[model samples]
Target: MVDTNETHVIVGAGLAGAKAAETLRSEGFTGRVILLGDEREKPYERPGLSKKFLTGAEERDALRVHDPSWYTAHEVELHLGQPVTALDREAKEVRLGDGTAIRYQKLLLATGSSPRPLRVPGADLAGVHYLRRLPHAERLRAVLRNLGRENGQLLIVGAGWIGLEVAAAARGYGAEVTVVEPQPTPLYGVLGPELGGFFADLHRDRGVSFQLGASITEVVGQDGMVLAALTDTGEELPAHAMLIGIGAAPDTALAEAAGLEIAPREEGGGVAVDASLRTADPDVFAAGDLASAYHPVFGRRLRVEHWANALNGGPAAARAMLGREVVYDRLPYFFSDQYDLGMEYSGYAAPGEYAQVVIRGDAGKREFIAFWLDGENRVLAGMNVNVWDVTDPIQRLVRSRRPVDPERLADPGVPLDALPG
Candidate 1:
């Protein structure tokens, strides 16, 4: 039960929004927290969509962050399935799709993001699907079961996370998987060129055919169902089911309509927020993948779409909104387990700027620890495949940010601790 006035209205009931609500209450705000969302379901975990859950190892119940009981216990008002269609910054109120307007003292927008659409012809065909929500996974699962037919092909456009992930799942289910990517390396943008090559080798070795440098020209269908995809290279590849994972675009329509200063998407871009995650309006704050805040160590405002970032940034934004200064200066980290290889890495490795790289094991064995050092031999990133020793040393090194002897680092004989103070 909200007080009806002087409430904190939070938009987008995803991980960031939910975490903010929990933090706000935990900080003794004692104020009304109204959570508004467009999705009917609860805030769900998205990481499993490509891994354990996709392989039928985990269930949908595990995707939940906090159940209905958890919110009820917090005394926060959950306005599920209701979206704030328009924002009145001057009045501090938002107009809903139902034509209802609600005012608030503080507004936090955590409108996460959406998968970028494929602009090819016949994209609206029946067999095409995009992975973003639970309903999407449900539909894709049904499509996977369609493999009872021998000639079915799963055409995945774009080599980004979702596409490759779906490819792994589809292939595991015994479907012909073909990944159409415009870039030479699949995870090139995030993992850097050198690491991206390592990822490419992993997928290629698993029987996944990657059509690199191939842009889909059109999706051809017959009788309102997808038949095959036409590429810019004048090749028509046959397919039964298709997935569009080109990339993700921030669901910024609600924010942009709010007259907030939005930094257009580029190499590193998002809705610009100050140190406090507050927009120009001051009272209105934004977080999660929708809002891009300044990174201290990285020295750039990155619009990261990582799952951990959303979970971490949510609490940080809540503290900031509560007039508590919190800095998100952590080294960005992410992991991907495709096939038998387990990869864990972090931070941004500059283009052609690896001053020194130490490889611990043979690449042929698919077991190694690759360390990237900056100009002064300070560990910028630590990567390990089938090796766990890399994690401990890398975490300590990045936090210390001190000097390290290159000769000692290159030599695995010397304990990792023996390299630097």
Candidate 2:
């Protein structure tokens, strides 16, 4: 039974924060639920920032995680646009940007990450954007609409999911698109060069150009507006607009200032937490991208930045905070859509952690289920591209941790369900 008078405070009003607040209410907690956010707007679904929302297929309110009425009805205090500036562990309080100090019985740090800024010259110029927030996406959509088809050039830096998605959107707007990726191929590190090449080919077939294994040395501008991007190889790519999609760094200043333990950079840096999402201080828990959580299946700590981690991790952290026995061992999952290519990935393994990749369909056709297996032929991770309804079997194979003949795994005739567990 929850003490109704107690207070539970959640920082960051993103998916993780909103989910945690909702979970608290559903778990019979009548205590005060305070959801703090740095943005003025209500919590919303972030995936749309790069997809439907950017494409003008969805409305602004459609992205909200919950309606304003829902928050009011649930009695969840809306502290929008007020960022937590300090965490006073001794006082068990969080100081907001407005200098308001609120005490809490239990605190959840779900402060998500921000785009890693491009530190090169001319990065501050006009016509350059980063797609991490709703406003960023809105501005980009406006640029695309104004630029008109075949009227301007858009140069995207990085070949990760965000970069590729933007490239697709820009191309759809009739903008000439060029992607500069330092990696040998798009998504090479995660999907491997072979699968990554398939994506490269996909973009190429759609009239999108790429400069693989290339890095932008500087962004050349004229009159405070972006003109072109110069590469290290002395090649200058003309661009009317540019987007930096390198990656994101977790927002950990508040946690660090509070003297919370942080994971090493190599382990995906963030506030360190055990399997139960509990920080060194039992009263505090960390979840979402800001949490470097220990994963039992991987036998290591992982900080995932995808939407699924926040979806599952938030509730897991909430339950743990309530003194419930909970283990956050869900397999990492993420999906992407670029043009005609739709893909879903389950499980996690850094590149080269697994020994081999087994394919069950044609990669050339872009309809396939690929499995990453260890030396013992145990599935470490699996992904389905342009394929449907096989996620369950693929996840089952990874979770079972049993060895199976790769030949059977790769044979469509064998059936995914028939694979030895």
Highest TM-score model number = 2
How do the residues 87-163 of candidate 2 rate in per-residue lDDT, one tens digit apiece? 99999999998899999999999998999998898899999899988899999998877665547888999999999
Residue pairs with colliding backbones in model 1 are none
Q: What is residue 67's positional error in candidate 1, in angstroms?
A: 2.3
Candidate 1 lDDT over 271-325, as tens digits, reads 7886567888878888888887777665667677878777888888888888887
Model 1 TM-score (2 dp): 0.92
Model 2 residue 55 lDDT score: 79
Candidate 1: C-alpha RMSD to true structure equals 2.3
lDDT of prediction 2: 0.91
RMSD of each: 2.3, 1.4
Model 2 poorest 10 in a row by lDDT: 143-152
lDDT of 1: 0.80
